[model samples]
Target: MRKIESSIDRRRITNRPIAIILAAAALGLFASTAVRADDSVGTVTQVNGSAQIERGGATIAAQQGTPLKLHDKVTTTDGSVTMGFGDGSSMALSSSTSVEIEDSTAVNGQNVPSRVTLISGDIHTIVPDKTGQPHSIEVNTENSKATGPSPNQ
Candidate 1:
């Protein structure tokens, strides 16, 4: 009887830790999902005709004023789109173009570390004037990368 009771006690101790670990893992998964649901980075300011936005593992039609999020990919089939950031900077994508919003951060109403990848076609960007802190717009293509005009320009 003494040996049986000791075994039962040990089992209970081990099970309690396992239960706690499972609960913690569940909580972490829930937290990560919630964070991803609220990730908006910019907005589609202009849509000439038809555009599509790939976001959250899905592709959806894009229109003017459509909200954009991190890792979002924008594609213009027969039209064009203009994406505007919070810092007054904008990217104009030509027809048959594809671009991805890789990363962006705003500081004091200015864009910092703003970057985009042009998968195909042409894009024109207008960068806002810089403040004291260094700010730039980076555009990456399959073959090249372009950084914005210097703070002096």
Candidate 2:
């Protein structure tokens, strides 16, 4: 009887710590998912003709004010689009153009240097003028890279 009682007491002590650890892990996982689900990097400001956005392997029609997330692929099927990033930088994609939002970090209403990759077609980028403070927009194309505001049309 003494041995049986001691065994039961040890099990109870061990199980309590295991249960606590599992509960804490479950809570941490839930918090991480909540943070990842709300990550929006930019938005589509204008869409003329037809445009689509590919996110997480799913493609959806592009509309004005459509929020853009990191690694999203934008393709214009029959029209053009203008995307305004969180940093106040904009990219105008011509008809039949495909581009990818590479990286963008905003500070005080301006992109420290938001970037995009032009897979095909033309794009016009306009970045905020913070002359002495240093602000820029980066564009990448096949075989080359361009930075700063420029007209690619």
Candidate 3:
């Protein structure tokens, strides 16, 4: 019985380092997820023809899986483009359209507002309906500004 107790104690002592390592790894994974959440406000799902994304004065070709950040100006030439946002919102822009992302942030599972400026062209936006949780988004056109689909929508 004494020998068995000693073995058990040794096993428990050895397991402490493994437990600590596991905890540290879990914490790292959580932190990485938090970092990844801020990486992009949305993503480019499809680009029909030619689209350009101007970020901080640098223009890049927009393609599938391209990450979109805040203040990104996207313009579509010959064809249209489609984008999916973080807060269950999607936007489809027709050809000869220009849009700028004003603000978008996803933090700690909170629903925040996003703003977009439609410099030109036609766009169809869809925001999810979340009854009590109010999620608001706004779009600005050349002449007027309008709110997107609210929580009721």
Candidate 4:
């Protein structure tokens, strides 16, 4: 009887820690899913004729769509426009260009976290410095691309 009681006590002690670990893991998964569901919206600060946006392997035309969100992409031809997103981050595009907004976040009424890929032609991005947050802007051409500190940068 003594040996049986000791074994049962040990089992209960081990199970308590395992249960706590499982509860913590469940909470983490829930938090991550909530974050991924967070939507980011973007607008055409400047536009002309017809423009289109791409994302998740799909393309969205300017007129047919309301707006765009994070991980969304944009394309243009024969016109130019500027895009402003949730965190005050903005990008200006020239004619005959295709670009992607890899990430978007907002800060102080501006889209501060931003990333763009210019598939062709030229584009200028004005990146804002948000407090202590990582920020990056990328421009891609057909053969190559560039990134830096300022829009003129």
Which candidate number has the best lDDT?
Answer: 3
User: Per-residue lDDT tens digits of candidate 1, residues 101-144?
Assistant: 88868666444336777888878776666553433444435444
lDDT of 4 by residue, 1-153 (tens): 455334457778889999999999999999988765657566777787667877678876765324667666677787876776655566777788877667655655544335555667777765455442324444546443445444332
Q: Arrange candidates by lDDT, highest first: which order? A: 3, 1, 2, 4
Best by TM-score: 3
**Model 3, range 25-91, lDDT digits (tens) per residue?**
9999999898766647888999999999999989999999998888899999999898987666778
Q: Where does candidate 3 stray beyond 4 Å?
A: 1-37, 107-113, 131-153
lDDT of each: 0.77, 0.75, 0.78, 0.65
Alpha-carbon runs more than 4 Å astray in model 1: 1-37, 109-113, 131-150
Instruction: Please report how far candidate 2 places residue 122 from its true position, in Å.
Output: 0.6
| Residue 8 in model 3: lDDT | 58
Instruction: List, residue by residue over 1-153, the lDDT tens digit for candidate 2.
Output: 354334357778989999999999999999988765666777889999999999998999999999888788999988999988665667888888898877867576434335667888777776666552223443435433455544332
Whole-model alpha-carbon lDDT for candidate 2: 0.75
Error of 3 at 52 (Å): 0.7
Q: What is the alpha-carbon lDDT for the whole of candidate 4?
A: 0.65
| Clashing residue pairs found in predicted model 4 | 54-73, 87-105, 87-106, 87-110, 87-111, 87-112, 88-110, 88-111, 89-111, 118-140
Q: Identify the superior model by TM-score, candidate 2 or candidate 3.
A: 3
